[model samples]
Target: MDDIDQQLLLLLTRDGRASAADLARELSVSRGTVQNRIDKLKREGVIEKFTVELGRGEREHQISAFALIRGNADDDRRILASLRRIKEITQVSTISGTFDLVVELRCSSLARLDEVLDSVRSLPDVADTQSHIRLRTWRS
Candidate 1:
């Protein structure tokens, strides 16, 4: 992507609901240009999908944590499939380290988080998991 496209993505990241006209105004481009670029970004898979980012007050009731997972390389497909089925597993990333994956979990309550963790631990291929509960957030 070019500089303009990168800037457009930044603006959208801050507010996904911004109108085409507003985005054009900020980007100093025509509305049609903004819309066309957005379409191109989506078509090229640079933009996966758009969804709401909950406000801090709404997120305050939720519990979030990160899990560093170590598993058998051959069993990754099975382990990852199991993780993807759990709605609480928001994000997962493959990492080059002692851990094979880093998982992000968000649940409504501590009890629910405990249950989700238990379920994750019981997955057949998951050999080891280190969890860190987030106490507070200073940034998004």
Candidate 2:
């Protein structure tokens, strides 16, 4: 990416909701140019998704946990699917290294977290899992 592309990305990363026209003005480029650059970014998968940063109060007050899961390929999909069904599980990624899957869950309370964990641990494919409760969150 060139300087202009980098600039556009930086601006958009800070405020995904910014209008193309606004970006154009800020970047000293045409609206169409801004739009094209954004389109290119999206096509390249550089721009993941437009998201709103929700405050703790705005969202369910919950503890966040990351888990390293182990399971067979088919079991991995099933486990992830089941985890996704839980409203509290906001992020799940199939990763490399010692862990097979990395999961992030947001629970409303300690009881809710235990409930989620119980559900996950009970899965037949899950051999073992490690979890860490988030003490603080800096950003989305």
Candidate 3:
């Protein structure tokens, strides 16, 4: 990706719904060029997927937390599969050090979060887990 491509990604990250014409205008490039670059980015896997960033009001009603999971390396695949089945688990990543995996969960209520946590704890391979609820967040 070149400078223009990088700039396009920044703009898209701020607003994924930006139109080709809008991006062209901001980047001072032709609409076709913007479209071509976006297509190339997608083909190259630089653009994995477009997603929505919830507004403050919407986020205010949701609870976010992180789960530090410890498990046997041999059961990584099974553990990941179980996590994938839980709709509240928005993100999961294998990590180093004390924790084998980190999971991000967002739920509408504390009760829902508790239920999700229970489900995660029930996984046979999950030996232990430490959870932290996010009290506040700041984003750029």
Question: What is the C-alpha lDDT profile of model 3 across 1-140, one tens digit per residue?
Answer: 79999999999998999999999999999999999999999999999999998899998999999999999665599999999999999999989999899999999999999999999999999999999999998769
Each model's lDDT comes to 0.93, 0.85, 0.95
Better of 2 and 3 by lDDT: 3
By TM-score: ranked, best first: 1, 3, 2
1 versus 2: better TM-score goes to? 1
Q: Report the lDDT tens digits of candidate 1 across residue range 1-140.
A: 99999999999998999999999999999999999999999999999999987799888889999998999665588888999999999999988889999999999999999999999989888999999999887756
Off by over 4 Å in 3: none
TM-scores for all predictions: 0.93, 0.76, 0.92
Listed per candidate, the RMSD to the true structure in angstroms reads 1.4, 2.9, 1.3
Worst 10 residues of 3 by lDDT: 72-81
Ranking by lDDT: 3, 1, 2
Off by over 4 Å in 1: none
